[model samples]
Target: MPKGEGKVLAQNRKASHDYIILDTIEAGMVLTGTEIKSVRKAKINLKDGYASIRNGEVFLQNVHISPFEQGNIFNHDPLRTRKLLLHKKQIKYLIEETKTTGVTLVPLRVYLKNGVAKVLIGLAKGKKSYDKRDALKQKDMKREIDRAMKER
Candidate 1:
């Protein structure tokens, strides 16, 4: 199966608008019991999530996994940083690629594959304001074309 073929729990819609994705990789997440439960219920947010490599490991930051409703004191923190599991070779490649200016690792989507949570991270470069405008214009034009074709 493809990297993000399973049921998606949360998607970072703004990530694509703000950055141009160059490549993507799938990595497993280390989640606590409660956190996994919340994720399974689709109570997760990836709006401000980003990945950073630290000491040769990658950590996901700013992603919010809401506390499980039925959980008591054992519920995990909603914004706790989580570790991402990736191969050493993949990590090395990410390190080299991210060393370039303006390049970053952003979590694009989170999904469950084979009952395990996986994150699809993208290697992206920031998009300028004008680039965003151009993309919007292109989308509008495509929409108009599709509308015209549909009416014919």
Candidate 2:
């Protein structure tokens, strides 16, 4: 983070390497007290997780939110499907766009924004192996240029 910038609670590193994120949408998570407590510790994983729109609402699937250690029996499920809160219009748009061929709704990151937990969902399209290699090439080229400039 830049100096004085807001602290980042968590990030999904796999999302950047695997998916081609075309657009981002912020959605609120419906979390219980125990779940929120685990999030505060940054004990969360958005890797291998996905979001889907169903019946005009969104739900996150397969995300691992480590159970709150102190709560016995009442601890939130580690892999429960959590509902996402989004505006009606935004939900509608996401549903429509994701329904198109080769596109999916991928959860990018989960973080606290201004005291509220928000998920940065991405409108993504899967990349083939060649496409991934091409992306890596571009990134490597840019890094090389930066290194060259720094040593000058």
Candidate 3:
């Protein structure tokens, strides 16, 4: 599939507001049958979710994919940790980057591309209160500029 093309299922909208994203990579997810079905229905939440490197593999934690209603006894856990599929080289790079102070792996969004589940993970650094305020100010200024231009 082409880059950045997908049917988005869930997004962490607060990620941009709370963190300074440095880079992003799309990685595939390992999902169960019921979990995938739930994801296709957009019953997923990325808020409070993050990725971590464990034993040389990346795993996504805190992401919630509700069990499929029709799954019955075969349903997967809604809050189970899921593995993220990425190349060894990419995992190594992320491991090194995450070792730095304040650097973290945050899941920005989840989507389906070419009928496969994918997640957009971002390398981020925490933003201080002042940084958030500055961002809000810049957004307000941009909106005002756009409004003024429209009035012209």
Candidate 4:
């Protein structure tokens, strides 16, 4: 596929910073017509979106799929919870892992795959304050090293 033609819609960069992702799964979302159109226009946000299992089903909440500009009063809510289409086995496994480890399910990305909308969801555990600080320090160290190497 061409680079610009096959573009990514939205991503959650903060999820990696705030949590340690242990597993990732690709799932489909149930979107309305206007929502799909809005997504095609790249009007979406997944930063605050998260996934959760309810009664054995998976749902995504806080994700913003902006309303289609041409739509009137029929537009779907931007932050409404959307159902995630995951396999039964995958859902079951995530539920078990979350229950055992007290981890969470966060939406890592929302993009198109082979012309279909797909969401990359991660199984993660929240990081401690020190862990975030350590990560920042490491990032700074790497930046400095890269600069030194370029100057050498």
Query: What C-alpha lDDT values do all the predictions have?
Result: 0.95, 0.86, 0.94, 0.88
lDDT score of residue 59 within candidate 1: 98
**What TM-score, computed on C-alpha atoms, does each candidate reach?**
0.97, 0.92, 0.96, 0.93
Winner on TM-score between 2 and 3 is 3
Better of 1 and 4 by lDDT: 1
- Which candidate, 1 or 2, would have the higher lDDT against the true structure? 1
Question: How far in Å is the alpha carbon of 106 misplaced in model 1?
Answer: 0.5
Q: What TM value does model 4 have?
A: 0.93
Clashing pairs in 4: none
Q: Against the hidden true structure, what lDDT does model 1 obtain?
A: 0.95
Worst 10 residues of 1 by lDDT: 1-10
Query: Which runs in model 1 stand beyond 4 Å of their true positions?
Result: 1-4
The most accurate candidate by TM-score is 1
Q: What ranking emerges by lDDT with the best candidate at the front?
A: 1, 3, 4, 2
lDDT of 2 by residue, 75-127 (tens): 98899999999999999899889888989888887777777778888999888
Worst 10 residues of 3 by lDDT: 1-10
- Selected candidate, larger lDDT, 2 vs 3: 3
> Which digits, one per residue and each the tens of the lDDT, describe model 1 over residues 102-143?
999999988999889999999999999999999999999999
CA error at residue 33 for candidate 2, angstroms: 1.0
- Candidate 2, clashing residue pairs? none
Show where candidate 2 strays beyond 4 Å.
Answer: 1-6
Evaluate residue 83 in candidate 4 and report its C-alpha lDDT on the 0 to 100 scale: 95
